[model samples]
Target: DQVMIISESDVKSLLTLQDAIHLTEKAYSELNAAQSMIFPAVREEIKEYQGIFGIKSSYLIAKKYIGLKAGGFWLGNAAKGKMNHQSTMMLFDAESGEPLCALSANYLTAVRTGAAGAVAAKSLARKDSKIIGIIGAGTQARTQLEGLLATFPVEQVLIYGKTEGKEELLAKEIIEKGYSAAICPSPQELAGQSDIIVTTTPSYAPVLHTSWVKDGAHINAIGSDTRGKRELVIDRKPDKMVCDLWVQSSIMGEFQHGITREELYAEIGEIVNNNKKGRENEGEITLFDSTGLSVQDLEVASFVYEAFKSKFV
Candidate 1:
């Protein structure tokens, strides 16, 4: 009857990018295999606070895990010396319908999202992709870069951000990590130079244009998880389009703007499950539209909970 409480420090110490990537891939596979069920996500805008609150929940049938993550973007948190994105997750014993654990999820959210993008990029991007471009310089963008570095032999990183000093700071961090990094004047420039591109901005309008993306580029559009948010401007359909989940992304993800379900090649999980093809050739343009998934949150939270128990219980 005692619910385990895991803090942000515990999650940070226990979960690594590599672990998140593996868990995210597993979660996707489970969902694709019909072993997991993700309930409809709820996102609401707190107009007075200029923030967004969302809830994502899921049940893993095979693993017997059930959980929900509640959190959102608080625009004013930065001024308060806090992260803009904040959330918490609660795990439950599906069999007994009892609460099992509560976890801080800000860091979890970043790594898992990066892992989701990496999972898609691994299957869709060309094997030789070395130059990566990031569209935002926030926590999510940094983690996305970290995830790509773990998956690809990246040689250079290009970043573009609306904020002046943020991109520079991120570039410096990447340089210190032993990679060549630079700031681009525009998203178009970044896209033209990168073999793999990740867009993590919370933009209501398109930040990247279709014509800017070069052939053989793989784009991970992870910012638009709400009904009105968008990042990519795709006038012409991509050579291949993949997403985390068709049910959610079709309505709220980057594809929600103009792309249809018919245009989507397959979900990332289907690609992982070998039910559908990924990148067919090197010159094809590939896009991964991620709205994030509750399964990802649940799986990673469950992992953190287990790790905590094994060590501290």
Candidate 2:
């Protein structure tokens, strides 16, 4: 087997945020159609490997994953198991099971998650939104900011984190990149000031409350990936509730804890594909409950893999 090795740098140079976004939108459409048929049939098989260390918890996750794009079948026993994660995205050929190329999952994951957030912002956020609030000062946070700036002409950004040092560092970096940046004293203050709020922390308790949010604001709840992790209190339902994956959100993340399944307005894919409406009126609160998805990982990985092949080989 000619296992083509792809380094992080190769992946970085291969795929751009713009390319990831376009591919992800296509991936979401495929997922929406396949979810009812594909997800259900394969869910049990997928879940059988749940908590298998690298497969579910640590190895793979994206807000809007496209299974065939970045993920692949893992065939092995627990005693001597080998995980096969594929961006074997063979859209380039039909006869050859031969992978066109390999992609680094780490970089792809970041791009897809960021692109998903941007998609939500485009659909759910107010047209004139200029200020953005971000919680957490990690890799995901940076990508969220990048994706937002790419999609929207954000003028100012407020960053907050559990640690002052990291928050200040991130603020400085953002400022140097030419965005007006500041570190907020609290999440409440950030919520009050920002037109679009994105929370990226892995916190169980609510970091933001309904009362803190202003009218006509868009909230992207990005951190709640697991069952006990949530950042927002469901005190009041938003005017529209969008999620990247309905089943995952309903069972595991932000929507898992507080909001009912019926309250969810639409999936981000539906909004992006124009199958449903988003941000109907002014003074409406819109929320994007992101649980992360497998297809996003697949889609981004596929994009990177293809790009790597085109440029390097």
Candidate 3:
């Protein structure tokens, strides 16, 4: 049997934010339906490297596949003209335990990650949400915008970044993408104007304060994947909050740093499957504490692999 190796270019060509969002939603629904399983994620801090190494593995029962993606952040690679993220996914046949395909997973990781935010926003955010506020004007900031556009008819986007020079750069990219976009001077301004807010920065201290977030706004806390990293400060409790995984979110996510299990309403999967209610009232603050998930990577990888096989064979 010939092993199929998928490149980043091939994956990017085959995958779109819309497809990723749709597939990821299905993945969450399957997870909530007990048709999928994600093993506990492993994240280790590489002190000398000043980054993180992680492993996410999962089993998709209905899809009859098992897979794992191993990679991590190398913070300085971008300056050296390499991707900061190095990830590869290996998919195996569930019954035979045979390797089926190997794929470059960095782009897969990004789109799937963005789709989780879209899933949360669609499941929990108010239906009338029109403005998207982005914190941390990086690749994630753009990806989040792409994902949201697929889910919501977003009218405008406001970007807030910690870095000085990158502000105009991200805003330009957003506008060039044919969206009404501009740079906001502060996170406070962005949050105040936005009906949906997404934070995508690696900051130790709180970049978003509860006071800045307007009532009835939805926030996706994306950056605080590891312990001690936080983007949003919970000075005032949100009305409803959910995470991808309760165990990981409680210990390694932003919840562990400032909030507790008692504060979170439910997992996003639970909300997606209608196991629990999402956004009972429009006038309440909603939050999704996303630490990212192995199932997400597995779902996208599996979808891409199937497509590759169909096209090639």
Candidate 4:
């Protein structure tokens, strides 16, 4: 009858970005192996506040974990001195359907999302890739950078955002963290210079175009998840178009805009399972169309729950 309640601080201390990456990667592999179940995402806009509310739920069979993350993004939260995106995760036992733990998931959401991009890059981006271009200056932008750095030997970071000074601020923070960084004057400049491009904005219109991108470059389109959101103008489809989950991305993800199901190369899980090929050559363009995944949240949540139990139970 009693459930463990874990705070944001506790989750922060328990899970690292690397840990989330590992768990998220494992989830993908398992999903491909038919060891997991991801229910459809439930997302809707709150017109009154220019906010979004959604629920992501999943079940990991072998891990015996069942959970869901509830909450969403509010554009006005910044004025209220709060994070734009907020969420809570609750885990239950898969066997008995008993509530096991509840944890503040703001941090988990960021890390897990970052992990998804990193995992995608590891499998698709060229090994020698060094420069990263990020289009967005928000929290997701920072986390996405963190993930790329952890996954690649990035020599430089390039940032581009519409908001004045935001890109500069993010660049300064990156430099302060001992990484080389610069603020690009435009998305085209950033894309032209980076070996890997990551889009993390909430733009409904395209921020990057095909002509701006170079061959052998990999792109992580993680910004657009809602129905009307978009980051890239898909004038030409990449050589390989991968998705974290086809069912979700094919409906509301970035690639959902002008790209069709036939254009999608494979789901990331299939590649992780070795059922499909990833990045066949250095001269090919690759794109990871991520819409986020409920299984990602479940895998990370289960890890946090276990870590908490071992320490305090």
Estimate TM-scores for all models. Answer: 0.98, 0.81, 0.95, 0.97
Residue 308 error, candidate 1, Å: 0.6
| Prediction 3 global C-alpha lDDT | 0.86
Off by over 4 Å in 4: none
What TM-score should be assigned to candidate 4? Answer: 0.97
**Residues 221-275, candidate 1, lDDT per residue (tens digit)?**
9999989899988976788988998888878898788778898899999999999
The C-alpha stretches of model 3 lying farther than 4 A from their native spots are none
**Better structure of 1 and 3 per TM-score:** 1
Best by lDDT: 1
lDDT of 4 by residue, 162-280 (tens): 87878889989999988999888889999998899999988888999866889999999998888888888877668998988877887778877767889889999899888998899
Candidate 1 lDDT (Cα, whole model)? 0.91
> Which regions of candidate 1 fall more than 4 Å away from where they truly are?
none
Candidate 2 overall Cα lDDT vs. reference? 0.72
Given candidate 4, what's the lDDT at residue 294?
84
Pairs in steric clash, model 4: none
lDDT of each: 0.91, 0.72, 0.86, 0.89
TM-score-better candidate, 2 vs 4? 4
In model 2, the Cα lDDT at residue 122 comes to: 85
What is the TM-score (0 to 1) of candidate 1? 0.98
User: Where does the lowest 10-residue lDDT sum fall in candidate 2?
Assistant: 52-61
Quote model 3's TM-score.
Answer: 0.95
